[model samples]
Target: MTGGSGGIGGAVARRLAADGTAVVIHYSGGAARAEAVVESVTAAGGTAVALPGDIAEPTEMSELFDAAERRFGGIDVVVNTAGIMRLAPLAEMELDAFDRMHRVNVRGTFVVSQLAARRLPPGGALINFSTSVTRLQQPGYGGYAATKGAVEAMTLILARELRGRDVTVNTVAPGPTATPLFVEGKSEEQIAGIAAAAPLERLGTPEDIAEAVAFLAGPGGRWINGQVLFSNGGIA
Candidate 1:
């Protein structure tokens, strides 16, 4: 699990561990937090390990996968939840900020997915993270949405590329989740307004998104491939 140190990624890691799956928590930084997650899982009688690497670096990610396989024996599910979001209208966005977003969100995803394609055994699943912003088509989200759009496109093509391998690849696009990343800069009124747009009338919890990811990584989602599961609560 890449980005396993973040809010949604931590939730996903914990949930998977609760389901009796050993997890390798990958983080770009936040080593202490990642270790905390690993300790929590172990305290609950689940197996987990914290691994740190640069998601955008192929060599680093390759080492991560190697260490994970060495620790767990084999890898079956790879959930890439590591990403950065910098919201700015296309016209106003700085080139550096846009490049940074693509470096982590697009390039990072590609590097990990490529390694997974080569390493994951048959019957494995690869779940990439996207955002409902693509469907929302909101202003100031063009750059972020473009990165996710690239992820979606790569997911579909990779699924076909892995034909007959029984390895499933899919993307999960979430909307208005109440994670620190989403709630940090917004005011209460802004958050409430966004929440009200969803039919559920609330911002999504990290666990809600984690549930969708757990499904795709488990047997119940075996038949689901080359698709994007929108866990947006009908906002889109």
Candidate 2:
């Protein structure tokens, strides 16, 4: 799982490990945080290893996959949850910020998906992260949503590209979630307003999103491919 150091990624890693999958936790930085997650997984008697790399770099990502295969014998599922979110209206958004976001979000996902396509064995699954904002049509999310829109498009086509290989490709688009990345900058009112947008009347938890990922990674979701599963609690 990429972004294994982040809240949602950490939850996905732990959940997969608990299900007896040997997890390769990928982090761009935060070696310490990643190590803590590994320790937690190991303490729970699950197998895990932390690997660091820039998801946008082919060489670095290849190294990560190499390490995972070396340690685990094979890779069954690849979940890319590592991404950056910078909100600004299109008019005010700096070109540099937009480029950085696309670098990590769009280009990064593409690179990882490409590697997964070549490396993953039959019966494997590749899960990419997106956001509900694409459907929500929320302002200030233009650039971020564009990247995710590209992800969704790529995901659909990749599934067909891998046809008959029995390797499923899909994207997971989550709604507003209660994570440091989501909660750090918003005021209580803003947060509450977003929470209320969902029928659940609350922000999604990291674990909530992880559950959707686990389903896609597991046998239960084998029939699902070339689709974007929205885990938004009716927000869109």
- Provide the clash count, candidate 1: 0
Off by over 4 Å in 2: none
Q: Give candidate 1's whole-model lDDT.
A: 0.95
Candidate No. with top lDDT: 1
For candidate 2, what is the TM-score?
0.98
Backbone clash count, each prediction separately: 0, 0
Tens digit of per-residue lDDT, candidate 2, span 1-236: 89999989999999998899999999887899999999999999999989889999999999999988888888999999989988899999999999999999999999999999999999999999999999988889999999999999999999999988999999999999899888897899999998998888999999999999999999999999999999989999
In the range 1-236, model 1's lDDT, one tens digit per residue, is 99998889989999999899999999988899899889888999999999989999999999999999888899999999999998888999999999999999999999999999998899999999999999999999999999999999999999999999999999999999999888898899999999999999999999999999999999999999999999999999
Each model's C-alpha lDDT? 0.95, 0.93
Clashing pairs in 1: none
Ten residues in a row with the worst lDDT in model 2?
65-74
> Model 1 residue 2 lDDT?
97
